[model samples]
Target: MKITQIEIYAIHLPLIEPFIISYDRYDTMPSIIVKMTTDTGVIGYGESVPDDHVTGESWESTYAVLKHQLAPAVIGQNPMEFEKIHEVMNKVIRDVPAAKAAIDIACFDIAGKTLQVPVYQLIGGRFHKKFPITHVLSIGSPEKMANEAAEHVEMGYRSFKMKVGTEVMKDVERIKAVRERVGADIAIRVDVNQGWVNASTTLRGLRAMRDLDIDWLEQPVKADDIDAMVEIKSKADVSLMIDEGLHGVKEMREIIAKRAADKVNIKLMKCGGIYPAMKLAVMAEMAGIECQVGSMVESSVGSAAGFHVAFSKKNMTSVELTGPLKFSKDIGDLHYEVPFIELNEKPGLGVTVDEAILEELCKFKDVVKEG
Candidate 1:
């Protein structure tokens, strides 16, 4: 089928608590959603994590990128021709891969619907009913963070992800407190978000974290310093999963070849859509790198796409698609009102948006376009 139309929306879903990181504070998540319609009556959906902080996308930028850069290339092309679309997107906007990725996700959704299969099947993963979800614990005093972890666990969550990147000793002290509170056996991982001091300190800190059973340390150093990353990887005993170091298939292969990291956290926005996501997974598999699917702060529409991608990867080492749980409110019917994002057995992503809710909770009415 051929594409007939494209629709974009700037969505803002408020978080229960302000999600903070070294980069920015996210009180309300903003994202660009793309919906494409084909001649044969199939509709595919996609979401983009804008470049800026707080949903990382603004309406103006999203529209300009979509209408002028991304949409133009894919308007009339066949959805099956993902390579051509990928090339077109990359050719037009070399660095803004997130915008290109949004359209790519919609194309993949359309492809799966047309082929009468779930998106995961196309990527070679069996459709499991539910995947274990890990809650995100913000950086705070060890006591406060531990309490939060305990609360989620009391609510039935068994896994926890903690944010670090502050001071090294302080980070270690907090992890120690959390480990003491949780009393071991629960999988705990630390996401430093590139907080380590330098290559030397990173090696020293990682050696300590390894002894603590950190499970994984994500992007412990600056993303660009692969040499530093490799040095840290060489010294650390725990698994080092690279988040910022991985972009797409090209960088994925490079990281594996260089041994810069042992695993990767594949964000939907980072990979740009399921097409590259699947491509990256295949590339990772060939190179022996385990993949983990993750998300930006998104409502169910965007979050479910990530879930499917994560569920479909056979070599999925760990997951971080817990955006829905961390946020205070969700904006659509695409999700069940539960603490965790549960997977369904329906066809084609298995969820739908509540337009009325979108109208009330979303920032942009329908399309993310220029004035």
Candidate 2:
């Protein structure tokens, strides 16, 4: 079927607690939501979490690009021709990955609906019905962080991710406290968000975490410093996972060639959409690199797309789609069991937005009619 209408919503959902990373702090999740309706009466939904520090996108810019560039490009085209839609979007602009991602997700949703199958089946089919989730601990003092880890552990979570890259000594202490609080047999990982800027500092941090049983250290040094990462990876006892450094296939290939990291993390916002996300994941998988699917502060509609892509791959080592858990509201119905996120059996993403809630949280709205 052909596309007939596209609607955009600018929504802001306040987080349960402030989410702190190396670059900044987030008190609310400012997102762009897309709804595309086809002539045959099928509607597909998508969401884009705009973070200037991550994807170089903002809520206002994402909305503008989707409205003035992407929506017009895809309105008359057949949703089934996914490649053609991409071709149209690419020709219109460059570097707006978050904007492109929203349209791409909506198209994939429509594709699954038209084919009468789940998006996972349309992509690579499900390898596991449920996947383990890694809950991230916000940056805080050693004692507070340890308490947070204990709370998740009491809830039956076996895996946790801690935010690091602060003072090396404090980071080390934070790791020690969490490990002690959680006890043995639990998986722990840390992400620096590119906080350690120099090779020496990164090496020091890695050395401090050497005996902590960290599953991996993520983006410790500056994202562009591949030589430093390679040096640290060569020397460190812990394995390394590249996050901010991985942009697309080209960057992934460069990191692979340099032997810069042992694993790669793929997020829909960073890589553009599920299409590019799957491409990078499969490409890394073939090269023997483990993959992890993650998300920004997205609603359920966006995280559901990430869920399908994560389960569709055989080499996905872990997931960090716990964005919904940090917020009190979500667009889709989801079931969470400690470490596992259960998917609904319905087709095509199987998530819907509450209009009343949408209107309540939405700061702006627009409709782009097919011409």
Number of the top lDDT candidate: 2
TM-score of every candidate:
0.90, 0.97
The regions of model 2 sitting more than 4 angstroms off are none
Candidate 2 per-residue lDDT, tens place, 1-371, comes to 89999999999877899998878888888989899999999999888987787788888999999999999888988987877887888899987888888998998898888888888898888887788878899889999999998988888889988988777778889899999999889999999888887779988877776778889989988777878889888888788999888878888989889888899989999888888898898789778999898888688888888988988888987889988888887666655776788776578887766878877889999999976
In terms of lDDT, the poorest run of 10 residues in model 1 is 362-371
Could you tell me the TM-score of candidate 1?
0.90
Cα lDDT of candidate 1 equals 0.73
Residue-by-residue lDDT tens digits, candidate 1, 207-319: 56665777788888876677787887777677888887677767776787798888888877776777777788778878788888877766666677777887776777566
Best by TM-score: 2
- Model 2 residue 356 distance off true place after TM-score fit, in angstroms: 1.5
The local distance difference test score of each candidate is: 0.73, 0.85
